[model samples]
Target: MASGLLIEEGEKMRTEEEMFQMILEIAKQDERIRAVYLNGSRTNPNVKKDEYQDFDIVYVVNDVIPFLNNPEWLKKFGEIAVMQEPNSKAFGWGGDHNEQESYTWLMLFSDGNRIDLHLDIKKVALDRYLEDTLTIKLLDKDDFLPDLAKANDQFHWIQKPSQIEFHGVCNEFWWCLNNVAKGLNRHQIPYVLKMYYEIVHPQLFQLVDWSVAQKNNFQITTGLFGKYYEMLLTKERYEAYLKTYPNPNPEAIWQAIFNACYLFRELGIEIAESLGFSYNLVEDQNMQRYLTQMYKKENDK
Candidate 1:
């Protein structure tokens, strides 16, 4: 049982230091928890640190059921903005039903801080947990945990697309754009947005990502949704990329689809040339022509 030096409620928002102390205190009080560790962005030196980054914590306990049963125990951390027990069978998680292997409680506090906590059962073995390069041991009472390797971004580093991956992404992007145009004509706003954002945009983004990676020798990252893309992108290409997200109006949506098509075409070609992978230019041309004709037909109506 960990000593939750319970931070009293009804006060100013708790700081990061207070949060870590409270977490360590909880581990200290509970003899059942033999060790603790941190993971995710917190341990990655490559990433610029931020307040919103999750405190990816792991509590190595001999048994998991007691903590699983007692959900209220988490209230000690702070005024919880929100919390989720994602791995529980009660939550309908499919695999191992969050078995003794490990379970999780992802939490956000009112103070604008979040702690993504995992309770890894001791019986699962230390070697399994150490596999993630983004891991750091916080506390080990019984010396149950071992000296893990230092954290690295190896797991997340951008990888050069294989010929199959490059070809597939190009095929999917060009193929899905027609769905957006058709949805627009049918006044299926949601459907069009879904096709563009969910289906086509990912591939477009990936193509642009490949362009970035091609320049950097496929080593650095652009982060989620190209948060770091601007720093890496040529000014002209980045501006064109920004315009791809248009207003929900049908005309704007149509234009944005064309914008994305042009960007993807050039980027895909560049990536293909650099990587020596084949590009589906004919499919790209056919889709562009189809979109142009569709736009004219819809306007004429």
Candidate 2:
């Protein structure tokens, strides 16, 4: 909990039951909201309990326009500190949701509770019910939402990578380092950081995911973008991963870049050996030389 949040003195966080009751009570009051269900970490049995887990709720309504028109209805939940309606055209992101079947409001209350509420028409919600394995039907006034299998994180598990995917990951990781080298040599911080984080980092993380999955028999979930990397990876490895993050200092950025390359190469070879896949040593060696030259050139000046 951040000290900056406007929580009243002696105010206590609501329990899970209280939160659920408030959610269900809200739906029960609004005749427009017919059914309610839960998604995300709240519904995943594998996820450990935490204070920050969100209530990913969906209310199956006949029409979403009425709710969209009257935004004040959200006040009934609690004293909201911040909120975002990502599906609303006026204040949204990613897509044009003018004709979309569902609308979402991501709310953060004063007491630190968050709810990612969704308003979906009955037909549209039902059509996609079976798609997500982590779903729990919370309330159904008319029994519209079907009974689902026990929620699991199987859908979120790190899958075993194919030979082609392995090759692609390795190729992309090494190939992108050249761009990082060029950007670093030119003293272009934005371009270098973008290439390092967005382009190179993803390929490295993909290899990490594959290695973790292979070691664990492809039966583990890393909890959304390696959020559980600390818990899943060895302490030394995790510490090394922490070192891969760099500040704007050129020396620190160069060190972070090298850390990422070494981590990627280490994990890449481990995965390749385990799966009997051919690892491209030549690409790795060539990229290492290229980055080293760039590093020396920049520091020598």
Candidate 3:
């Protein structure tokens, strides 16, 4: 539709069905394309669709060499605005052996639709994708693709936490407060930011993730790094969580570090109580006081 994808039969805009028909039509023309499938968010039943969601397609073929070398085949799908072929020499691919059997084409169409298409050698490696719960088979001529046990969101569900694991996070959260103070005192942004993210924030997110897991009886996901916190968290708790983010200035960063400590202490207590573990109030109080003292001294200097 952009320029050369051939909006065939006098169609102006290429719709979803039309795109699928175009993909399948190309596969039908070639004997090598033995199977067709879809993966990623497009196959996830829970995910909401928008114009930006990519059409993740996989073509299981007898061979991948022709598709690898030929650039003409790509234009058939649509006028490609931009294309990334990862395993190609032109794209900094190592050599022939690295990707001899499989290849990838991340195509962006002119009409704002994108498709991440992969061409793989049939039978040997294609079965690996069939097992993933977030996949749907579009076509299989010779019954090559296997039957999955069941396709569901079980792959991302939250797992139960052990006491040792739980304690480790609480200890890690309180201990790392010193590092952030040290970074702030030294006027080093990297150290402060790193300690906050790699040490402090993981625990913050983990506590929230644990809270969600507890509320849901460890039966659901918290998304990738508590992205679904708003959905699962109470409005009051969520509003408090929002106050923890601070601007990059020294004073703001100082306030943010304390905010994080308070939030973590609150969430950690709830989670520890729920899990029947002891929450270290002594460590929390000691760390909070130490952080305040360090911040005050740094400002006085």
lDDT of 3 at 182: 86
* Runs in model 1 lying further than 4 Å from the true structure: 1-11, 93-96, 125-127
Please give each candidate's TM-score.
Answer: 0.89, 0.94, 0.82
> Candidates 1 and 2: which is better by TM-score?
2
What is candidate 2's lDDT per residue for 230-250, written digit by digit as tens? Answer: 999999998988898899887
TM-score, cand. 1 vs. native: 0.89
Best prediction by TM-score: 2
C-alpha positional error of residue 247 in candidate 2 after TM-score superposition, expressed in Å: 1.3
Score candidate 2 by lDDT: 0.86
Worst 10 residues of 1 by lDDT: 1-10
- Provide the overall lDDT of each model, using Cα atoms, as 2-decimal numbers: 0.82, 0.86, 0.79
Clashing residue pairs for model 1: 1-29, 1-30, 1-31, 2-26, 2-29, 2-30, 3-29
Per residue, candidate 1 scores C-alpha lDDT tens digits across 1-301 of 2222233355465666887898999999989888988888878887887667789898998888888778678877766766677876666764577565677888877766788888877766475576777888889998867787778767666898899999899899888888888888889999899888999999989988778877887777777778877888889988999999988899999889888988888888888889998888899999999999999989999
Comparing 1 and 3 on TM-score, the stronger one? 1
Query: Each candidate's root-mean-square deviation in Å?
Result: 3.8, 2.4, 4.2
Candidate 3 per-residue lDDT, tens place, 1-301, comes to 2354433455355678888899998888888899888877667666666666788888888888777677688888887767787777775664674455778888887666788988888754565675567777888877878766545656777887899998898899889888889889999987788788787888888887888889888877766667667878999888778767767788888887877888888888888888898888999999988998998899899
